[model samples]
Target: MTAPGRIGIDMVPFTRVRALLGGGLLAGRMLSADERRLLLDGDEPDVPGIAGRLAAKEAVFKLFHATGETVPWQGIEILRAESGAPWVRLSGRAAALARGAGIGSVSVSITHDEPCAVAVALTAPDSEERSAP
Candidate 1:
């Protein structure tokens, strides 16, 4: 069996995200092109969706445990599978952090309500760890 993985959860208020996204720069900095497309393709009133994505990113960031490092927001790309499930793609420093932490695949789940959004991230142990039995 695989080793138990790390879990991270975060919640974000829609209004807060809305204000950040209003400047547009934060959205560009935080989201990948595909993620931005997904946000735009979503239904009207995009604040909740943005908040959901932001929360997902924050949740994934927590899994890294990079205490003194700056959050590589763009490196942790949160995307959707064909089945509409949330998946994580790590790159750059985020990938390095995951490797350092023995994190393999990262999965995320996001939900939105009127006022806020919440997300949870789970990081699977690396293959070597899984094979260590």
Candidate 2:
């Protein structure tokens, strides 16, 4: 039987979401001093990759069920598998939350068509996990 644990699901029709993130990245420099403080307060990567990574980032937050506003979006990175799956690599508070939840692994799947991309994520504990008494 499947064990009980936190589960979260989020999807943005690849087309629209990609555009939102891509645009946000491009305008990073153009962002108002206030806007910059919100999304790009810390180090960030090249603009084009922002869309895919941001999608994965949101997914991780959902799995951890945390809304750490202090956590920078850059803390979550999306690593690709040979089969083209995107995996979550969390850092900072996000990583801490995953560890606290006893999650030993995370699984993610991403799909793209034309100018859009979509992803689904699952977080699970290692076999070492034991149900509470």
Candidate 3:
């Protein structure tokens, strides 16, 4: 059974994402079919700046078995620290749920390759090691 202090991790391959979102890319400045073509022809795939963040949110939901309620998208945002360490941005209802769940901290890792992006999330219980006799 899932516990209050349980931690979960999930991974998504870049190729899969590319296949899914490739067609969605239209001719545009931000991202377009031409860009997709270039990506397909080139060695590296170019994922949008926001793709990683979006995937991270989904990954967080998966890890927690939460439907964006306890940890809504608005609550969890991906950010890059000065050291280039990616982290989450918690706020609003999402932050409240995390606190109530006794979550001391949460960590996320995100990577992007072309069309698809992968993300990992880790949640730690507020307290570890119950009081022992």
Candidate 4:
């Protein structure tokens, strides 16, 4: 059995993220291809959504950091489910670090309101608890 779950939370301001988007470089540096596509494809202005996703990613990084792992900003991907729920998908060194830390699942919740976006991340050990007999 591994350690118990860990939680991380983060918040970002929409105005700050909007300025970053205006510059055109921060989005490319921080978001993955799929994430960029999702943001751009939305009907609403992309600032809030992008800010929420960025907060979610930062929350995930905090989770990893609490576990003593360092992952790049680009290594964490936050995606929306068909039902519009958010989830996390790690890649490259992030995946390896998560595996080594015995973190089998990472769940994220995001919310946005006029000026700010907030996210909470939960990281749990492998699924053995469900399979225990």
- For TM-score, the strongest prediction is 1
RMSD of each: 4.6, 8.8, 9.6, 4.3
Error of 3 at 130 (Å): 22
Per-candidate TM-scores read 0.84, 0.56, 0.55, 0.83
Question: Model 1, range 1-133, lDDT digits (tens) per residue?
Answer: 3226689999999888777767876556887777778776556537777788889988988987879987788888877777777778888999898777767777789999989999998877555322211
lDDT of each: 0.78, 0.53, 0.54, 0.77
Q: Write the per-residue lDDT of candidate 4 for residues 12-35, one digit (tens) a residue.
A: 999888788788865677888878
lDDT of residue 40 for candidate 1: 64
- The reply for model 3, stretches above 4 Å from the true place, is 1-47, 67-71, 125-133
lDDT of 4 at 89: 78
lDDT of 2: 0.53
Clashing pairs for predicted structure model 3, backbone only: 45-114, 46-114
- Regions more than 4 Å wrong, model 2: 1-3, 13-50, 67-71, 114-116, 128-133
Q: Give the TM-score of candidate 4.
A: 0.83
- The residue-level lDDT of candidate 3 at 19 comes to 54
The lowest-lDDT stretch of 10 consecutive residues in candidate 1 is 124-133
Q: In model 2, what is the error at residue 8, expressed in angstroms?
A: 2.5
